[model samples]
Target: MCKKVFILFAIFSFLLFSVVMGNWQVAPSSAEYEYSAGDSFTVALTLNGDGNDIDALGFDLTYPGSLLNFRRAYFEGTLLDSWMFKQTQLLSEGVLRIAGFTISGAINSGTAGKLINLVFEVKATASDEGYIFPNSFTDDLAGATGDTAIFRVKPLGYSVIGYIWYFSNHLPVPNVSISLANYLNTTSTSGEFSFDLIPEGDYVIKPEKINDIGGSVSPFDASYILRYAVGLTQLSPSQLIAGDVSGNGSVSPFDASYILQYSVGLIESFPVSRDWFFLPSEFPLDDANWNSAPDSISLSPLDSDTSGLDFKGIVMGDVTGNWNGGLKKQTAAFVSYRIEAPHQLSQTKIEIPLKLNFNQATLAWLVKVRYQAVGSKFLSAEVLGKSENCIFVSHEKNGIINLAFASPEPLGNQQIMVSLYFEKENSLSDKFPKIEICKARLNETLAQIINLRENDEFQASSFQLLQNYPNPFNPETLIEFSLKKQGYTTLQIYNTAGQLIKTLISGPMDAGNHQSLWDGRDEIGNLVASGIYFYKLKSAEFHLVKKMLLVR
Candidate 1:
């Protein structure tokens, strides 16, 4: 019985040792590769053993026929290197059959490595994911099959996505041109841009745009720039670049003047060569040398999808950074003030004073006036009581006039801001020329003019020459007067002998309140003896004289 048990054990051991276990697979169980159409790639077929040898192997390698084409297989340094017979053939559209055997003997159970290398050429545009799988592993000597190998080919390219925004408001900027490699795309309404099918390589992305240089460029921009130049305020790097309208590398009053000129339509274009400039969103805000920084984004050896590569747009003359990428929708506010000039067509000339009734002080104002009457033509305009530190500009196009004024300090109310003069032509029609205020702003805020007062009827009776104060006993006196019309006027002092003593005023004067000072002097700047003096005010339509006693 013991001998029988020993024989059975020996038989069992021989049978177990003779069993051949084979595991066939591709070298890389699963892989992903990128390739453009018409490109070529390779994969290896490999085998792993469970201490069992296989003399022959056969399998079918399947792939997407539309994306890949089968090429020659290589076995120079694989397990099938010394095989006596090796065969490979295309069984169908995308199915490849590979078979090999060695007549020398079965391959050593421990000898396991790559068997063959399968080559394929990309036939067309690849899908998102393409697979090359090995199936039906059968051999002349075999055991249990092992895990299958799957080779996945991904489309050969990455995506680049980004956005463009306005530097001031962070609003999306549309219609901007974005470039990567040799491809170009325009931004959508949402200010988003994207580029696809980009191969693996270093690339530079650039943005470009052409816009109106004068958009959103107003007197406020000039004021802001002036403040920055004088160290009264701060400016960002981009603002500094925009304030340099002359392209002179620095901000100055000259640039402010140029910008103001452009805003008022004095100049058609800015001195800067480019209307818009773009910078990467990641650009440093503290970079004082922003002008020297690269205006493009660089991707070195880009291999995957990249997004959020945003940019900021800067308009050249918009120092206040109010440009909305030329996409702004503006609605004028209600009228805050009105000046009425009710004159018959019989009058040859008319003057309209823009007087505000509000008591609020303002630092800036912009008024747009429309004179649409066919019988009247605008002659000229002037600002009354204008401060020395203030900047004022007026532009006239067709029958419209734009008046922009900015002051470093707030101007008091109840003052005449501007006076418009017009010349009326003789016409038989009784229609009065319409002088309307189309728009008005007070320091960037809309103001309303509730009443339109007719000054023509009240103007003639309003002229007056007031009595001098502290008269009869002073070396100096103040004389006040009011004019109903704008014309060449004169104020003179004379002695009782009727000889002219001194002329205090002699020039074209606006129709408003005026004052003059007489220091008891003669025409040659000599002090006169204490005596009686006559002061006279004369204009085109009015004349008056008053007497005062000068005492020493």
Candidate 2:
């Protein structure tokens, strides 16, 4: 009876001690992993002791047999480094058994650390699921003797995705270079980019692209920068970089001046060395050193599949953010205007006045003039009258003239804005010079140029009446005609039914080209309804009629 009681008491003590010790578990460094086929990787086996000392530990690890090739096991820099006995074996095609024990002393209580490292190489592609699992765990620790510990291993791949866009319009910028470590990718036409099979770690991403810096820089951009300098507006971080055309690390009115000069071709390049700049979409605008921050992006400790790593692209002088990779669309249609030069076939030098006929006020304008005739030299140009308040710049090169002007205050209407002087070679006396306005801007909208001629193409002996400008009129239109000799002229507007509505001119005129403005009205000044109408020019030697339309 005493032997029976002793054995039962010992068994009870062992069961109580086991209940107090709890279970010991071994797990991988990460619960999940990502790798492509033919890529090599490492997995660390860590020991987690539940306040229990361990002298020996062993486990059977199972992996995807067909997809992974087992390399070798490492035990350096681990809790079992001083173990007297350590062994690792490939028990089966996909099963590895590893064990280690220290005979020198106990591994110590509450010791939790890495036990071994398992190396592997992916052989084939497979669906995402459990790739490595602890099939069995055993340890020579008191109390946790037959308890099963849960173990899991997942292998989900990782990717980095992002987009690039224009800072001004938020339009996609394609073909931009995006880099991650040693990997590189170019954005698609949709401005989307991605890098697959990336490992989990810290990285810095960068973007780069270079393009012709023409047509994207304009006076509007300078105006935007000026507004920002005066605290009248705000600009994004990327926009600030674009506004720093002088490369002085800050934006100022002087930068605006430089940008304006570049827009008008007064300066061939910006003081900034680059034609384009970029910033991460997630860049902190409120950072104290944001103005001096690097252009690249940082992904500190990227540990998962990351996305939405977008970037903003800026043209160096496009502070208003209106660059669309040189494919900008017009905001408004072109409105045609004419500038007539004085008929001078006898002089070798002449001054042409650039008079604009408009009732509305203008804040900015840019005009590009091209001289079609050879040997005609443009001497100088100057702003006159109210236009003198504007910042004006003009550059003439290779028979092309670029004029850019901006005013803080509105320029009044119906005035001569500039005067251009030119000298012609006497050898080309018989051939008339033709001046064409290649491009023109009034405010922010594009304007059309019509009838940029010295005089009418007809002979001096013939009387002529030209068609009215903007034949489909609104509330006004211009009537132009030429007289072979001085005489009394009557220009009358009549209804389509041949009844006279109003007489625009009834007086003696000189023998030259003439123009008259016809407001859409009757003789009493009442606005007429929308319809087709005719105008007749009757003189002693010329009689002609033309049709026009007016829409209210």
Best by lDDT: 1
lDDT of 2 by residue, 64-95 (tens): 77777899877789877778998889988888
Question: For candidate 2, what's the RMSD?
Answer: 19.9
Local distance difference test, each candidate: 0.73, 0.72
> Against the hidden reference, what TM-scores do the models get?
0.51, 0.41
Kindly report which residue stretches of model 1 are placed more than 4 angstroms away from their true locations once superposed: 2-16, 19-139, 144-150, 261-272, 287-294, 325-332, 335-552
Q: Against the true structure, candidate 2 has what lDDT?
A: 0.72
Q: For residues 1-552, what per-residue lDDT tens digits would candidate 1 score against the true structure? A: 999999999999877756644343344444555566777877776666555666777877777776778888888988788889988989998788888888786677656688788788876764444567677666743343434344345556888999988888997888888888788999987889998888879999998888644358888889998888789999888888778788878888998899878877898777877777888889775547865655689999787789989998888888888776543234333334557554442457766666654446777888767666657777777788887898888887767788888889876675555777767775554444555554566776555434354555323346789777457756566676778878999999999999999999999987755556676777644578888889999988888999999999
Q: Return the TM-score for candidate 1, rounded to 2 decimals.
A: 0.51
| Prediction 2 TM-score vs. true | 0.41
RMSD (Å) per prediction:
23.2, 19.9
Best-matching candidate per TM-score: 1
